[model samples]
Target: MSSTRSDVSVLIPFSKRNKDQEEALRQCPSVQMSDLIFSDIEEKETLLDYVQRVKKLVTEENINIILPTCDLSTMVHAAIARDFPHIPGPTVESCYLAFHKAYSRQYLDPAADLVPYAVVDLDSPTMLQDAERALEKVGFPAFVKPAAAQSTFGVAKVKNYQDMNRALQNLRTMRDEHPGFKSSPSAPFFKDYFKQYLDVEKYPLALRDVVIVEPYMDAEALYTVDGCVVDNEIVRWAITDEHRFDHGDAKFGQDLIAPTSNVRRLTEAALGCL
Candidate 1:
């Protein structure tokens, strides 16, 4: 491989969303970005085609990095980077476990120290029974979200079983109408992959439609720890304090203040997420 430009060039697997990131990148002469009409990963065929398309672009443009612009692109970027050998990205297996909340809980440490949660497969024959058990685990005043989602889109705060029923019903019949569900890079792309590529008995969440139910964590404050892993070492940066607006129930982050503190707990939490 020949290196031409000293400046960095990146390929975002998804199309340009005219986001603030694009504007910010334009201000930096040291950075260049490439995007196309690409959208969500609906299936395995689309995932493979996207991988090949990125491979060609990376070679032709001499792109130095393949960046994932959204949650859906994590695994896709991993697939593209596999061929380059030099491009550094998370492995597909790691990304797979990370992106799906239930999967993360199942395969990772399970965050037993955190709130106990439940996973209910929407398509399961025992869904109602599972939900009943989930309610028992989480009880009233619960938070619900998709098994895999983009940001806070499909998330909802439920004070009762009625709310859970409505949320689950929307997830079943009105998925397209759900903002969080639509915002996601679309489709439960892992469904078929689990059948063909992995052990279904071990990772059965992929076998059916699933959602997460957990106790609502009420806090007077929230913080996000920013950091990066370099050469397999994790370094702490700054922690951002957040305040969420009450959406009839507390939901959205209305205000953010960064560099709020240099706390060791922040670093520990950030590493846990990674």
Candidate 2:
């Protein structure tokens, strides 16, 4: 298909409402645009519910493409993309491997120097015990984060056993408070979704329940690339270097600048591995 706006029906999923996206679509003039409510797995609405709702909207509205602006929405759209071929994003398998930290670690199998980490499954009855073991292996000055979460929701830096325990306790409290869908099978819409991508017996813990313990890196800069794969070819779009505000214990992105060729190539090499 041509890259013309007239030939595409784009659907963007937002956590609440986004006036920016609406304004961007208005400027386009020829594109068909719609919104899909973005639901967190920890929220009252389940992932299945969100996907089913989106699938129905796509069918009724004839949405030809999904532009997932959030991590949760990316996974949701990727899961259902098989039914709707025009969604421009990663495949279901790739999304599962990439979005889930633990699974991605296993799939990528990065060099020891690149990533030294261990996965802890919170769904297990012995999660605390497993975490303790992981702590011992990863040692002090490490990070504990949910395997499939985004926006640094369940991320913490721990320096000692006491800190690790406190972090784990906080994560457990969050999980207890947010208990996701009681049963996936009970939701008829999830039948096909599960059959296509899920194997509960194999991966006992859901993606969200998995956690990773990894050594902390005191990095001075962060870089990212925005790209896509079309016709089995990787296309580079843009690269930017992220500047962050460091506040003793935490860091947040403050600005982004287009990097030079050398930095862009380095970032491209990293993306190639993925």
Location of the lowest summed lDDT over 10 successive residues in candidate 2 = 181-190
lDDT of 1 at 233: 81
Candidate 1 stretches with Cα past 4 Å from truth are 1-8, 15-49, 110-112, 176-202, 236-240, 253-274
Q: What is the TM-score of each candidate against the true structure?
A: 0.71, 0.73
Worst 10 contiguous positions by lDDT, candidate 1: 265-274
- Tell me the TM-score of model 1: 0.71
48-104: candidate 1 lDDT, tens digit per residue: 455666677778777656656456676667776666786777666677787778877
Cα lDDT, all candidates: 0.62, 0.60
> What digit string (tens of lDDT, one per residue) describes model 2 on residues 1-274?
2233444555666455566644544444334334333223434555666677878877877776666644556667686577677654566667656666777777674555455789876657887788889988888789887776655556778888787778777776766665553321112223344555677455544433567899877787767665556557765756767655565675544465765444333222222222
